[model samples]
Target: NSSDAFLLYRVNEAIRKSGAVVEFVREHIILENMVSIFGNTEKQAELINILFLPIVWGFFHIIKAFFSTPLSALSDKIGRKVTIIFGWTIYTSVYVSFALIVFLPSHIQIPVTFVLFTIYALFYAFTEGTEKALVADMVPEEKRGTAFGMYNLATGVSTLPASIIFGFLYTYFEQQFPGYGGTFAFGFGGSIALLSMILFSFLVKAKNR
Candidate 1:
C-alpha cells in the first residue's frame, strides 16, 4: 500500500471503536446542545465549520515551523525541564478551560467556544514541540526508538476502551440528560489531566541539562 493509504488504514484501525462515539458526540450531543445555545442554528454551525476547516486543511509544515523554532531556541537557553513544565502548565490550563466551557450553562455566547478552541490550539503548539524535545533529552539515542515505539503503542492501545467508554457515556447521558455528554467528557478529561500533572510533578525529577 502507498504511504497515504497505510496511514489512513492505521488511523482507521486505531480509532475504530471511537468513531461512533465521536459522531454521536458531534452530531447528537455537541450539535444539538449548540443549537439550543444559539437560537440561530445556521449561523452558529457555519461559524464552527469555518473555524474547523482551517485547522483541518492547514499545512503541517507551517504549524510545525511555527512551533519548532521558538521551542528549539528555548531548549538551548532555559533547558528542557523549564520548557516541559511550562508546556504542561499550558496543557493543564487548556483542559481546565474545556471543562469550564462544557460544564457551564448554555447561556454563554457562541463565539466563546471558538475562543476556547483557539486557546487550545495555541497550547498544543507549545506543548507539542517541547514534548518531543523533552523526550529526546531524557532518552539516550539508542533508546529513543524504543521510547517512541512505546508511546505509539500506548496511544493505540488506549483508544479502543477510551472510545467505547466515551460512547457509552455520551449515549447514556444524552438520552437521560439533554445536554450533558460534553460536560462528562470535559470533566473526565480535565480531572485525569489534573491528577496526572499532580502525580508527575511529585514523581518526575527533571535532570539538569
Candidate 2:
C-alpha cells in the first residue's frame, strides 16, 4: 500500500521465512522459536504461524486501502508535514508493538495482532500518496522528475540493507540471542522512524518558514 509500510512489511514477512534456510524451517519459523525463549510449547506458538497470519495481515491492507484516499486528502486540509509525521508516529508504534510480541502468549496473539494490524493500516493511510505529494510540495516544479527519481532511489537503496539486516536477525541473531532478535531489529527500526520524524520537523520549519 505504501513505501514505509511496504518496507516494514518486507521486514515483517522476512522475519519468519528468513528464520532459517530449509523450506520446512521457513514454514515453521518465527512463532515457535520466538516463544521457546520464554519456555512456551512449540505447538502452541505454531498456531500463529498458520493460516491465521495471512488472513489478519491481508485484512490490514484492506483497511488501509479503505482509508487511504480520505486520509491522503486530509493532508490537503491540514499539511503534508503534519500528516506525514502522524504516519511516521503510527509506523513507529507498529514496529515497537511487533517487537514486543515476544512478551505475549499464543492465545493473546489473535487479539493483539489484530489490533496492531488495524493500527498499521492507518500508518499506510496517512503516508501512501502523501509521501510523493510531500516531495512535490518541497521541490521546484522544474526539477520534479529528478526529485521523484531521487526519492525512489533513496527508498530502494535503503531497502536493500534493511531487508538484509532483517533477514539476518531471524537467522543469525535469533540463534545468538534466542528471543531478542525481532525486538532489537524492530526497536531499531522504530527508533530510526522516530529520529527521522524529529529531523523532518526541523526541515519543515526550515523550508516552510
**TM-score for each predicted model, relative to the true structure:** 0.60, 0.73
For candidate 2, give the lDDT of residue 171.
57
- Model 1 Cα lDDT, one tens digit per residue, 17-126: 22322333356665557545654755654455444434432443355456666765675577665665665565566555544454443334234444544544455566
**Tens-digit lDDT track for model 2 on 1-209?**
11344334433454344332123333566744644564344554354444455766688889998999999999888888889899999989988887777576544544666688789889889997988898888888999999999999988788878767666664576689976776777777788889989998886642341
lDDT of 2 at 46: 51
* Worst window of 10 by summed lDDT in candidate 1: 1-10
Say what the RMSD of model 1 is.
10.4
Q: What stretches of model 2 exceed 4 Å from their correct place? A: 1-48, 170-172, 205-209
